[model samples]
Target chain A: ADVAAAQAASARQDSLTKPPRALGRLEELAIFMAGWQGTPRPVIDRAQALVFAGNHGVCAQGVNPFPQEVTAQMVANFDAGGAAINQLCRASGADLSVIALDLDRPTADITEAPAMSADEVLDAIRRGAGAVDADAQVLVLGEMGIGNSTIAAALAHAVFGGAAADWVGRGTGVDDEGLTRKADVVARAVERHAGIRGAALLAALGGREQAAICGAVLQARALSIPVILDGFICTAATAPLFDADPRLLDHCLVGHASREPGHTRLLHEMGKAPILALDMALGEGSGAAVALGVLRAALECHNGMATFAEAGVAGG
Target chain B: ADVAAAQAASARQDSLTKPPRALGRLEELAIFMAGWQGTPRPVIDRAQALVFAGNHGVCAQGVNPFPQEVTAQMVANFDAGGAAINQLCRASGADLSVIALDLDRPTADITEAPAMSADEVLDAIRRGAGAVDADAQVLVLGEMGIGNSTIAAALAHAVFGGAAADWVGRGTGVDDEGLTRKADVVARAVERHAGIRGAALLAALGGREQAAICGAVLQARALSIPVILDGFICTAATAPLFDADPRLLDHCLVGHASREPGHTRLLHEMGKAPILALDMALGEGSGAAVALGVLRAALECHNGMATFAEAGVAGG
Candidate 1:
């Protein structure tokens, strides 16, 4: 982070027409953006949102309510601009891209073996990293996969060392029976991959979309582009990076708290607070896209509001 | 609210490609707007934001840090499109207006006597009701007054039967001494007018802005326009109406939870959850304006997203 720029932005906020820190978290957000953009006044003229969709092999366990084919079908819906993410991106002024990662070739079901080989994880990461637009001022990362919530639960349990039930939640809406099966799948997957650690744990229990989110986060950080992470699945996807290095998420914000029970716990484990808490659980960057509007409002106020001196207003 | 339209909107949400309730509060918000707009798909093409500015004679108690003149100065800043509210409204695509209420004449010092005569309060209410634009799909109500926080605290204490200290806060940056003085002033004012009740409490303890907010809220409800209320001062201004009849606020949504310690308690007392909680305390309708973006996103997703049949996607 650019300390000098952050300091400058904080100083500017105090000089704005409003009371000192009256804008609360908005002042902190503007300063955070200033540090990332390396400018006292930062603006997001170009925002990019990426949705990575992949089919989860864990569907063989009957953990998810939706069929595996739904992943590819949702991707087609995204392409047709008929998905929630499409409408959200249009409303938030974000340019969106949908990337389907080996939908026809699902990873090995984690209940039986590692979800992906090390090479496969690396390949997905590369694909995610390559999708970043260097010119974009901000990035929003989300995912779409049939059984990824179970994948996310297994990954969270592996990294955070908690009860499987604590990390499992109904992804897209599941019945009581499906919920029980999902918890069982998560428990079995985490116990099987208990020995794996760090980023390799992703290979053991995570899917392509998860690895891609990690890659995209890394790429955005490399290019000094701040990222807004989506819901539980998205947060669990990048947990490996956070576990490896706490500073890895310094340029990111959790977009919203999801209705999925594990999402709040995962966010707490990561010591992150989401920008919005509308209980949204859709994982197509929808929450992140909505939060983009708040970020834009923060920047607009930061860059457009006249200083006390400029407005000839008295400061308290 | 049109129950039929709300039901229709809720039904439409279920048919959307995403999981049931995946959009969470956004779905509820869309349904609420649909009920208010009397349509299954609501759009906010003509949102109106009204900021009522007034001068408080309660400043005689040294309850505020800024001079009363700053209220008028900020109004001019707003007119010049240089304040936070102006920038936020521009970013959120809301039409903005500033109504300065007899700024040349400050209200009576509430510690000594009623803040405004009953006639004066009614006149202010009339002005407020007159300010509402009939064509507006949604109304955002905010206020600007130098000592309004103290006024809000007193009004809340008078209406909600709370301890004066519980309703007092350091509005717009006040030192420990000022906070103590503000609390003392609230106690004295509430004690002085112990018999006041319902809408009459506003005249005894509130300023013109508060009365105007009450009027605007009533007018919006009469016109079937949903209202998004600003922070503590604005909320406290309308507390009298809520105290009179809980149903009076059915058309209203608290835009954001304010940093003022009393605001959250006030929201709890009224059983209203703010749409956003960015810790914002600047009350020029700034928080409500920011929430307008969220509301717009909800409506856009509701109106624009393709249904399961349209997208040819499978439902769980």
Candidate 2:
């Protein structure tokens, strides 16, 4: 962490006219942004979202309401700029890129076997890492995959240390039967992959989009870029990174706490609070895209406003 | 209520590719915007915030930690664009207006006497209402005051029918002793005005800015202008308006649920929900200003997004 920059930002914060800690979390976020950017003044002036679209074999287990092809259909919608994330990104002045990392093929059913071979998992991570824009300061990682929440649940159960009931949620609003089936699939996958951990556990129970998201998160951290995470699916994808190195989370921010039950559980584990609480559950980085507005606002306040010394306002 | 426009907006929402009510409150807000704006395609393109600054006599009861002069000081901060609301307004592209309605003197101690005479209260309301801008489409109401939480708690307890303890909280992080004292003061004020209701209760217990905010809410409704409400103090001031005509709520949107305890109680009394839950209590329209971002996003998606028919995507 850039302690010197954080110190400078804090000094500015205390010099503001209001009482100490008058701005609350908003001020804390500014200091955090300063340290992350390694500057007393930081901005999310240039932001980009990468949508990693893929498919989950758990769809074969009758785990979701939508067909697997709907993933491709949604990807097309993102491509044509018609989806929720597209509108949010466009409205908030963030660039959007939809990448079909592995669109045509679904992962192997994790309940019976590993989702991908070790080599494929590594390649998926590389592909995810490769998509981060070198110039963008804030990188938002979102995903579009049908029945992927079940895989996310399995992954969360493995690395994040939660029961299937806690990890599984009404993904895409599954019916009662679908919910039961999804839980069963997650339970079986967790038990089958009990001995695995880290990248091996991710490869055993995670989706291609999830693995790629994991890679993107690591790459962004390595490049000293701050990452904004979407809801349950994306959070589940990055669970391995957070579990392995808690310090890596200093580079991550939760865009919103989704209505997905497992999302709160995961957020609790990460000890990172979301910037917005909009009850949004439609992933594909929709929460993160919407949150770009708050991020930009925080930056503007941190960098643009006059301090008590400058405004000639008395301190309390 | 612009029934035709609302129905048209709802039709567009249904025609979108997502499941019915899949977008949840986001779609509801869009439809609500259409009804309020009298157009199927509604946008909060031009928004403004009016911050009414006043002082509370409740400070004499040792109900707060800060001196009353801080209210005037904060007003200067608002004018110089150094306060939280100013920075938020600048960041979100909202016009900011700070009115020192009655800051030179504090309100009368509520436990011993009425905060304002009936004529003064009526005049305060008129001043609040007169600040509305006809050119603006979305109007946000916020306030600045010291020891105002005591008066707000009293107003909420008297108007919204809640226990004084239930309505009281630490404003600006008051110590435990200050909170207990504030509660005692609110309890006494509620007892003193036990027989009064509506405008009489407000005039007896409210600060000048609260009365003005009450006037602004009514004026916005009379002009068919949509209002975005700030936290506890403003809500307490306008409680009487909400009680008199619950239908007026159709034109108002709660910006966020303030950390102030009375805010949730008052919101429940009005049967309204906030757009965001940022846990902010800075007042001065700060919550409303940050919320401008969410409102703009909702409007953008409502007016600019393509439907299944427009995008040629399959219906779910």
**Best by the TM-score measure:** 1
Best by the lDDT measure: 1
Name the TM-score of candidate 1. 0.99
Span of 10 residues, lowest total lDDT, candidate 2 chain A: A16-25
Tens-place lDDT per residue, model 2, A1-316, is 6899999999987776655665666777788778877899888768889989888777888898777878888888888878888888987888899888677878888878888888888888899899898778888889988888898898888886656888888888787787888888899989988878776776888778888898888888888788889888898888777667777668888888888889888888879898887777888787888788887777677776667677765544
| Worst-scoring 10-residue span by lDDT in model 1 chain B | B155-164
> Alpha carbon lDDT of residue B12, candidate 1?
96
Tens-digit lDDT string for candidate 1 (A1-316): 8999999999999889998888988888899999999999899999999999888889999988788989999999999999999999999999999999999999899999999998999999999999999999999999999999999998888889878989888888888898888999999988887787778877998899999999999999999999999999999998888878879999999889988999999999999888899989899999999999999999999999999999999873
lDDT for model 2, please.
0.81
Docking quality category of candidate 1 according to DockQ thresholds: high
